[model samples]
Target: MSESMITKQAIASGFKQLMKEKTFDKITILDITKTCGLNRQTFYYHFQDKYELLNWIFYNEVILVLTKDLSLDTWPDNLFHMLTVMKENDTFYRNAINHSFQEEFRNYLLTISEELFCSIIDHIKVNYSMPEEDQKFLSRFLSYGVVDSIVYWVKEGMVRSPLELKKHIVSIVNECKMYATKHPTTLL
Candidate 1:
């Protein structure tokens, strides 16, 4: 990466490290820049605010990993991996979600979920011709359900293991699709 990207990443890394100790809302720009050995101006040159940095962290760290090597047939695997990533970074993620980063995380989840689901659906789609809007709508609906569930899990202290959560979610998704398939709803 170039020097600019390196510095930006260093700033994000510092913020993430701070998140391990405190919530995003409690963190200040000075704390992040000081932790990373940068200055306020340097931080602003790359990010508008700590929330933007949080978005960057989620997009680069969590979303990228969630979407990496994604395949049409690997929805379950992808879900599993995402849950695993969240579980591994429980403190960081839980702190962000519980704090001011909640909205950002929701928006990010919707966007990436829609994008990935649309790609997978388009690839594996059969003769059925769901309109692009319908595909996107369905993707958003599913995204909300999944993301909200994960948020709830985090709020409830993630009582379940990642594998267990993945299994349950995959089963629920498959069952929902099966129902929707057998019922043949034109609205879908």
Candidate 2:
């Protein structure tokens, strides 16, 4: 990797390590720079703030990893994998939600989940003759539901297994497929 990439990775690593002991709210830019032995300007050069760093880390470590081999057929499995990753990084995730940027944390998941859902839905090319807005609405609804399920599972200390969550996800997807194939009487 290039030196710039290396520096950025080091910065991300430093922030993650700090998250183990301190909440995101408690961690300062200085803490990240000091942990990585880099000057404050270096951290600023790559990230505007700690929250942006957190978003970068989430995109890189979690979203990128989950979407690497993403396929429409295995979206549920990918979500399960994401849950497993979150479980493994429970400390950082839990701290992030409970201590800082709670809404942003949820919004990030919603954003990515919506993107994935919309992509898959488009690829399927539903022949149900629905409006474009309707398709997008379904995507947004399901994405929000899935993201909320994940947030709730995390909040509950992940008592349920990833497989259990996967099962629920699959069931929901199948039901939506069935619904799309039918002429619904109500959107509610």
Q: Looking at candidate 2, what is the lDDT of residue 50? A: 89
lDDT of every predicted structure (CA atoms): 0.79, 0.80
List TM-score per model, in order. Answer: 0.82, 0.84
Question: Which tens-of-lDDT digit does each residue in 1-188 have in candidate 2?
Answer: 99988998999889888999998878899999999999999999988998888888787767776676777766777777887887888878777767786677688778877888778667655564566787788889998898888788877778888889879977887788676666543444
Best by lDDT: 2
Q: How far is each candidate from the true structure, as Cα RMSD in Å?
A: 2.7, 2.4
For 70-100, candidate 1 gives per-residue lDDT tens digits of 6667767877887888888888888988877
Model 1 TM-score on a 0 to 1 scale:
0.82
Kindly report which residue stretches of model 1 are placed more than 4 angstroms away from their true locations once superposed: 115-138, 186-188
Please give the lDDT score at residue 92 for candidate 2.
80
Candidate 1 lowest-lDDT run of ten: 179-188
Residue pairs in collision within model 1: none
